[model samples]
Target: MSLHAEPEIRPVPPRPAYDGTSPFPRTAPLLRTPGARWQLAATAVIVAFPFLAVVLAGWVLWGNVLGPVDVVLAVVFYVLTGLGITVGFHRLLTHRSFTAAPALRLLLGVAGSMSFQGDVIGWVATHRRHHAFTDRPGDPHSPFRYGTGVRGQFRGLVHAHVGWLFAGDSSPADRYAPDLLADRSTRALARAFPALCVISLALPFAIGWAIGGTLHDALTALLWAGLVRVALLQHVTWSVNSLCHMIGERPFRTRRHDRATNLWPLALLSFGESWHNLHHAEPTCARHGVDRGQLDPTAAAIRLFERLGWATDVHWPDPRRLDGRRQ
Candidate 1:
């Protein structure tokens, strides 16, 4: 045969068939099979109860018993728990935006646990999944999932806000949160989530009782600082998944379907997480509020930690790099 002539073609190497199996070992689904209808109903009731109480308090006790103390407590608790998630769970754990000392790591982990959103590993897994398949079918919560019409947007907003949590599907921790899973201390903390939840609820009551020295005061604090605080935090967090995706300025470009935005109104309440467009564009930057006027309490906290030597390798935004990301 001439040198240029093709040799008898060897049987083409069998293409590696996906066969629908992931390269990594499969994990048991995080959520159990659909629970009894009553279980779901109970969850709904529990979630709704806090909001109902907030409404009732506003209606019945706004000026009488709900005073400055209640307002201050609400703001304090909200800031602490909000940062626990934004700084601890989302930035540090999920995105590795900064490095923290062991003490700060443990503190942040515990603080995030007190938020009672979910266990650390579970939260990280769900959030990672959110980024991996943002606004797509596999996304855990996406305001665009249902459709683009008015009615569809309404349904999608609600679903993204809270309904997705009730869905039977769950992000696989092994696939999305291997780093947290490998950390023995964090894994242990995740396993103790139930106890942490109890402590989260009771700590407010205890603090109120200690400060006010009355059952009524304690009860009010529990209502405002505990339940209402949690409800407000939950809604704010959900807004990033729902409202942030639906409205505001997308200053930075991201993955085609990642509809993150900068909803300025939510900045302070969400500890600067409302700068979602920048977040998606630069996932590992510690500061989501990259612009000059953006207010980022979480970034402030991270800066303080760095100053205190509790955090290192902080990834503050670079103007040049951010300029390139801008739309």
Candidate 2:
């Protein structure tokens, strides 16, 4: 065998998307509407804890606020819970991109529940609705909802980033996620969402307390791993909706109004979801980063599960299919 590389694989071309209305109901207006009670409660914790951490860091911990252990704790939990959403709530539940062993399925579901995003049913409903409508009128969070103008774009960005959460508009699971709603086990898990959030936060604090064996250490751990970690991941995930849509390459052709784009900057932070263009074009593709050098940790995890006999039916991107999708 030769030592140096001899051949290279060319990148695949983009594809066109359907320009159509979402199957989700279009009854509610996307204005200043109230969110669900569960949404309001979760938002409070996600906001309050991070805010508190900042204040405490400024007033008390200062230089000692984020230590090595705190960093490790945050990184570990961040990857774990992040995968829970990307793999469990998204690829597996929302798209059925692949199948997994019974135990692995349960593990992904439980881990994803810890993200404080929403119950599995609700999250899947919203996401499926997103893919269905994309950047059109029914999209739950589209940066182009307002208009293409400057002021409108700013408003749309803010709305897409987080404002849509409070807009009272929600995907009807009956239409978007009937499959999940029909599953008794998934229903039970959705019911336990609130409890899972508690564990998500408390577990970090407990781990910190155990490792450091001090009040300060425990608090710092909670601040970094529990509060800061959640806040960071939240923004990164939302950025896909807000930033990715606004700028970057749109090599793939979605609906006339759809504005999904590929942002390489967020590839690692978003676990390959930043390849928004590819994802919007191929929603069920197990790997968003299909090109060479495109890092997709979530896809890698799915592959690992396949190797461990945990996941099957992996949908690695096909170049021929992709090549046919060139704009």
Candidate 3:
């Protein structure tokens, strides 16, 4: 495919006029449809399940303590799948930070699905909408949506952290991610999400079972390496929307009201995603951690891929462009 221009993504317009005669089309500020209840229930399960797994691994179950092998499995999965999100879902798919070879794109998409973060299309659509709106009203996960003040900020944090997901504020794929929506490969991946989810959890259990040949080993791996790892990564990713926006230093300037900030502590774990300030300022730049001493494994991985002839046209940071954004 040819290198294409970044499609302009405009924020959702302010409330369109509606006549009282019939319900006009509009995005819901809060989920109100009957399906909203089911979505809320699913969100509750997703948010609570990992915490439960962690507690069980640490204390609740007698056989739950993870062995060294389990720890290794967890770490490996965390790195691979986390990069799947940061490099594949966020940078390559959402921002088109680089052009990936067909085989590389397929591998990245599948690896990203194994993280259980959602399918590629939905993930790209949601993230593109986020870049389009940042901390503004239409942003599905803005930490400032609830307004100002201690109480409001607290509410905003909660909303951005996880509550916005239950609000059913899904960005339409056609609207925000038409390029991905139009792709045959991506559409196939989106259709495979359910099967991929089962594989995400089951693959670790299979590994543990093969290595240890015991039910206890398999169960332990399923909990710690599977559920616990996914849960931990999920919160780290969500923190970019919640904690990064609310706390970290904004050393880079962005469009007005873009509250993205750089939270250094999460740099390694979030795979450079915590350099939120730089990200919002230059969304398509492949490297988020531009400054010296900033560890960005994702950017390094992209470079490695480029060297191997798997990724091309990577938008490496330009000093002049970045200097302009520095504040």
lDDT leader: 3
TM-score of 3: 0.91
Q: Which is better, 2 or 3, measured by TM-score? A: 3
Candidate 1 lDDT over 10-109, as tens digits, reads 2323433332212212234445535635545645754676686567577648567575666787778878878889999988888888889998888888
Error of 1 at 23 (Å): 28
lDDT of each: 0.79, 0.79, 0.83
- Worst 10-residue lDDT window, candidate 2: 1-10
Query: TM-score for every candidate vs. truth?
Result: 0.86, 0.87, 0.91
- Runs in model 3 with CA error above 4 Å? 1-4, 10-40, 60-65
lDDT of 1: 0.79
Q: What TM-score does prediction 2 earn?
A: 0.87
Runs in model 2 lying further than 4 Å from the true structure: 1-49
- In candidate 2, clashing pairs total 2
